[model samples]
Target: MKRWIPWLAAAAVVVLVGGGAWRAMAARQQQQKALAQAASQRAEAPMQLAASELVGVVRRSLVLGVPVSGSLRATESAMVKARVAGELQGLTVREGDSVRAGQVLARIDATESQARLRQAQQQADAARAQVDINQRTVTNNQALVNQGFISATALVTSQASLESAQSTYRAALAAADVAKKSLEDTVLRSPITGQVSQRLAQPGERMPIDGRVLEVVDLSRLELEALLSPADSLAVRVGQRAQLQIEGSAEPVVATVARINPSAQAGSRTVPVYLAIAQNRGAPALRQGLFVQGLLDTGRADVLTVPLDAVRTDKPAPYIQAVRDGKVAYLPVKTGARAVVDGQTLVAVEGAPEGTVVVSGRMGQLREGTAVTTAATPSAPVAAASAPATRPAP
Candidate 1:
């Protein structure tokens, strides 16, 4: 009976040990089952994304171009300067005043000019009288010489005096014409039909010759001057089109390449490209010296492309997050050239076909295999806000 008791105790000990092992195995199985259920629930829940967080791939003509920026200038501008030195008078026009070609804009005090002109005219009149007297004297001397009443030497001396008087009279006439021109210069006229952009000299102020008085610019025709790199400028040609965003203007202005500087700038070595702006009706008027920036369309290419912001570089290889079968899928792409389409900067890329819905960089990183739906769907934004925040696997 004692031996039987020891054997039974051993069997009981084995059974207790077996029961503990069974409990541990059962608990582990329950835990794993619970984790699997939770994962399935997460997967079933679709993340709702805003419309701005996604962009569609498109295949269209991509405008290949170089980025350019510069200031707007009037194609025909004139600087009205004083041609005569005198006190400015009758100057009524100011900045923003309209002017017409050959219209009298202002005048310098003509008192000094008129006096000089009168003096020159009087001198010319005196010279004219002297010329007439010299002619009469030459005729009388010739007659006397012919009749032998005067010696030949005396007649020759009289002829020399007459010649000197005639030369002086011609010189006086030239001086008078110069004085008349100076008098006319006192009256300033607009060389072009446009609006005055600047009024440098005021009325009653003494103006010197060639002194700037007013600046006139024809807003009807404007041009943009852009400087570009040598390599980029090489591709630029006359007649290329560009869209410029002018300062203070809401609508973008269209411009065409007009001319290009043959030689590069000395210090910066940049080429200057002039673009003539086309004035469109109902568009905001452009002004000279306004800041402008745009892209010069050098060429065009038709290809599948996406917004440049859609290409993600946060991974070992450049990839874009695309929605495939309603799940986030990372697509590896080989990027090509960048271009602007419809004013948006887009990049050419392979591995993605047209009409593929891809995530925008603004959406941040999303986990693989995650289900996604647009905000228009019934899913609430609050529910899926945390879904997009999921970090990608390393």
Candidate 2:
């Protein structure tokens, strides 16, 4: 009985130990199952966004410009020069003085020219008197020849004397006419209605040859000359609407393309185009020789444009993120016309609403079906409000 009791005690100890090991293994398995279920739920979770990550859209007027740039110049300018060598006795006008065509401007010394005129007149009178006296002699000599009181030789001499007097009178008359013209050339006059920009001669100054007297410029009308390449010139045409900013004017002046050069300069490959300012678009302040910059509206264009900030270009191709169905989705878009508004150019998107919000956040980092609640971007301005050509020059 003692041996049996010892064996039973050993069996009971082994069974108890086996049962304890089993309970421990079951508890470990239960804990591991719970951990796995929790991990699976976490893997299927959605991402949330911070409110501060968004930016606002700015709208402005986007003017399509076919920019052709060049300088300005006066339409009519003449460098007046002295016609003959003489003393600049009298100068009537100063620089900036307005003058008319055929108006006398200056005078030169004419004492010598007057003397020549008088001398020629006296010679002509003497010749006329001599011809009168010779005519009487010729008449008397003819009668004497008929009466046999004079020889034929004497009659021929009388006729010759009358012819000589006639020739001398003609010669003297020609010299007198020349002297009269020289005397009249002493005073000068303006060629056109314009302001004298430069005064090159002074009183008592002797001018020899074609001496420049003054420089006159017509400032009433102005022309703008623009130099552009072949392709650009081809795009713009005559009579197209053009907008330009004249130097020193905060506002821009309006003009129209007056002329286009069909042929281009060979070496520069540039064409010279002219723009005439519309009178209604300006005041007296806008004069000639004011440097200007301009753009021509080649034609009207229809295009879809969106704020550049709403579109992301950090990638190889341009794309925008859109919020749909409680989530953020990476939408691939093809971009088109780009126009500047408040210094931002909107990249065009297809089939998009007129004022749609493209996710400007780091949504490029987010995948499709991401849980998102879009907070509106700050409201700023509409781009068309700031259009460049809306207002006329003041």
lDDT of 1 by residue, 177-261 (tens): 9999999999999999999999998998999999999999999999988988887888789999887787767798888999999
C-alpha RMSD of candidate 1? 9.8
TM-scores for all candidates? 0.72, 0.60
Best by lDDT: 1
For residues 1-394, write the lDDT of model 2, one tens digit per residue.
Answer: 7879989999999999999999999999999999999977764665554434433333333455567556665677777777667898779788879988788888878887898899999999998999999999999999999999989999999999999999998998999999888788776777778989889989889988688888888776567888876666766778887778776777777778888877888889789888877666344366555677866766534545555567776678656666666676666667644555566455445655544444554444666566666554534334462233211111
RMSD of each: 9.8, 11.9
Prediction 1 global C-alpha lDDT? 0.82
- CA shift of 123, model 1, Å: 1.0
